[model samples]
Target chain A: MILTNIESVPGLRTVEHMGLVSGSTVRSKHVGRDLMAGLKNIFGGELKGYTELLNEAREEAIARMVKQAEALGANAVVNVRFSTSAVAAGAAELYAYGTAVRVE
Target chain B: MADIIVFIVLVACGYFIGGHRERSHYRSIFAREAATLELTLLSGKAIDPAWQVAQAALVTGVCVISVDYFKSVAAGLRNLVGGRVSAYESLIDRARREALLRMKAQAAALGGKVVVINVRLETSSISGMKADGRSGQVASVEVIAYGTALALA
Candidate 1:
């Protein structure tokens, strides 16, 4: 399916709107990763592990959202948005939402 | 006594190492931004109708940058006085620019002239709270930049 974070896909026309679809997931860092991050905090740099973890989680969330759109018989998802929240000390929740539509 | 000594050492290390990392990151960001100057990044949803579009797809970039011990401690002191916390300011700035740069790189990889539309940035603090809901010194900040990349025809 075509995905765009705009009102409509470029070079295509929206033929139908399929309401809204959303997916979310919460992830927590493992103890080892948390310990390493604690040390990295002292020295200061990119938390590569956490970055990868969050990115993977976001992709999964997007995939689930896409699945929902597909089930609704939508050909594209538009006006997509992502949000991240700290669910707990080491846990983070990533949410992806968009308007599903049929494009021609 | 020993704990105080370790605290001092950590602060010293944080000062030196964190400063170096920030400087280098800025330098790299500048270079990459210049390299990708031809690619367009926009926040508005409207796209110009004149240009022929070949393809459009979702693109995203994420960055997680940590604050040094020294800056967090310095910010804590600023909290008491109620002034702008400049140390955290630079941290967030770096994270944002880095995330955008990575997004631009992805746009460039789409194999043609491209413009990113409806770009949005989301920033959140991570590892900053405990199970008891008590917030600690912000260990790191996360920034995600996403948009629709339209390859020109």
Candidate 2:
């Protein structure tokens, strides 16, 4: 699927605007991973475990968005935006939203 | 006596792991940056008129970094005295740069030359109030680097 954050695609013209489609997911690491990350925290470096967790969550969110766009019979998602928030200690929410549109 | 021992250990751990990892990450960033010198990355909203965007896609990279136990302790002390927490400065810096590198890597993998416009960075702290019935402490933060990738038509 073609997704762009700009108002319009450069080559193709937007034919229809399908309002807004969004996807959200909340995720946290397991206890084993958290413990390992906490130990690394003492050394102050990249927490690979948490990084992988959030990365997966983001991809999943985007996938859901793509599914929504497909359901709307849209060829692309435009003006896409992403947001992340802490839902609770150790839990985070990633949200992706955009305008689904048909470009021709 | 025990407190002194713990203090020394924390500093030792920070120097051994955090310091080493930071130095290596910097070196890697600079090296990879030179390799990707031809690509463009900008924060402006306008795309170049000379180029026609054949395909546009959104790419993202994420990095989560944690403050070492020693640094957090130092930060707490600095909070009392009202000065810069020098330890965390590099931690955040590393996170931002690493996140950007990952974004660039994604752009390259997609056979794209540059990140056209609308670059955004989001940062959030997510290591607190453990969901697993363990200690809830805020030591790690998540950084996301996102932008649009445009391929030449």
Query: Which has the greatest lDDT?
Result: 1
In candidate 1, which residue ranges exceed 4 Å CA deviation? B129-134
TM-score of chain A, predicted model 2, versus the true chain A, to 2 decimals = 0.95
TM-score on B-chain, cand. 2: 0.85
Q: Could you give candidate 1's per-residue lDDT for residues B18-45 as a string of tens digits? A: 8898899999999998988999999888
Could you give the interface RMSD of each candidate, to one decimal? 2.1, 2.4
Q: Please identify model 2 stretches exceeding 4 Å from their true place.
A: B129-138
Record all residue pairs in model 1 with backbone atoms less than 3 Å apart, i.e. clashing: none
Which digits, one per residue and each the tens of the lDDT, describe model 2 over residues B87-151?
Answer: 77887788888898888888877675555578889875567634342436657757898888887
lDDT of 2 at A64: 96
How high a TM-score does candidate 2 get? Answer: 0.92
